[model samples]
Target: MTILRRLAAAAIVIGLGMTALGLAATADWRLGLIVNFRLQLLFGFMILVAIMIAVGDRRWLVPAVAGLAINAILVGPWFGFGLGTSSGESVTVLHLNLLAANRDTAAVVELLHETDADIAFLAEATASWRRRLRLVEIPFDVVATPGDVRFGIIALSRIPVETRVLGVSTFQLPTPLLSFDLDGEPITVMSFHTTSPVNTRRDAARDEQLMALSDLVSSVDGHGVLIGDLNATPWTPGMSLIEDAGYQNSLRSSGLQPSWPAGLGPFMIPIDHAFHSEGLEVIDRRTVASSGSDHLGVEIELAVKR
Candidate 1:
């Protein structure tokens, strides 16, 4: 056979290998850290599969197609290519993890104005940043949970805000649970920022936070919304808690809108997310242009199961 055919065959093997590793990650979090990286590599593996398919080798065609099919199954729905289905009335929500060290508060203000979301959440906010946000006025009432030397949580909403700090966070970050009264309807809103799972301690903290968030989701009696930077991808074992909690990802129908490390373009992982209970559904979802921060902002339109 030709050297090109050999290369195509080799590439197919690599793609399948990587896809397998990503699937393995779903089982648990012990390999969560490593498998998360492999999951990211799925993009490149799919590219290689495409290249081989384009090369037109009969032997490589089947493997290449299979690789593509796997991605199409696992990653396809994230791009919102799923069968178009309607849920409830649309209420827009914008969520972002504003870098605490970022000095460009003006960008946040502009993004808020640009998205014009019914509710907005800014995580990793500093006291000064909170003060700056006070300047720009939107239709929603504002709830700034600014405590000293912790992950500052802030929320802006048109609905009535009922702050509920469930229990103390193991990571000492702000409680993610917030309740809102919108047009006589009660919606539980949680602004969560799971601790970055960069290290063992932090990963443990992140796991704990997810557990707490899951419990909070299960405990809610009415419609609920969870918005924040979860740090873990949806496929990770850490996210299983959310799945077990009976919540759905807002972007599931819309597609995977990668939100972090903005300059990477399509290469960024989607750390920021909006998850809601069965009582709520995301009717429309979109990601905004990078708001001068590492993570891109996400705006989702939710429909309550009325």
Candidate 2:
């Protein structure tokens, strides 16, 4: 019983601390990293409350419940929000971050063939990947930027597309901004990857890149779709900045579609995402099977709003 009490107290303290950190996420990059695990914290609090109830520990109940509520509020929007209900022309997109070290080019190629998406956006398209893809005859038109193990972005399209490569983020990685027509309407797409904010410098660079991308998205005249491994969660300032640009997160309808650290299964958090502008709405959204990459791809169908 003594041990049980100690455990309960620790849980309460840790849970409360996490809640506080998430609330103060914008204060520091490290805090923002903790905020990314809001979903995990929510689950932890839930289990904590359940244990408290079963053990008849009313003393720890109040604070534990409070922590649970705070986390619920923070992560609730990903379950569902203003989901697009537009019945207009739609296009399917597959966005993946192929791990630079993974050499299973055949599996990746097979997955791409299986999905046969209207447009496929790939990150970490290193020279090795380009060489492997070239040997095969793919059905889609491929547009790729010169990429090494550290940087690269590619787009494969079944429809006609005009693409421009933009240097983004602090490292100045190649990002593709693609333009194509969908059912007579001009639509734009940006396949981007931000620096993983593991440190202060990378965090600032990620934010700067996010702001620049948001401005670019806002400048589009008709409709736009943004997809990739953003290295930021929906609750983070990075995603909020993009949302502020008039784009809606597809996860709002798809729920918390966690797509990173592919081996973790239910323990993973969503860093990869798909967002559509005001003129376009999400018709469907889901995560694809693993292609030997640490990150699983996101499949989204977006429609032009009538």
Q: TM-scores of all models?
A: 0.83, 0.94
Model 2 C-alpha lDDT versus the unseen true structure: 0.84
C-alpha positional error of residue 116 in candidate 1 after TM-score superposition, expressed in Å: 1.9
Least accurate stretch of 10 residues (summed lDDT) in model 2?
A: 143-152
Candidate RMSDs in order: 3.4, 1.9
User: Model 1: per-residue lDDT, tens digit, 180-247?
Assistant: 66445788777777778776677778888888788878888778888888998776677878878998
Model 1: lDDT equals 0.72
Candidate 2 residues 123-179, lDDT tens each?
A: 888787777888987778887565554457878888878888776655566778789
Number of the top TM-score candidate:
2
Q: After superposition, how far is residue 252 of candidate 1 from its true place, in Å?
A: 2.1
Worst 10 residues of 1 by lDDT: 81-90
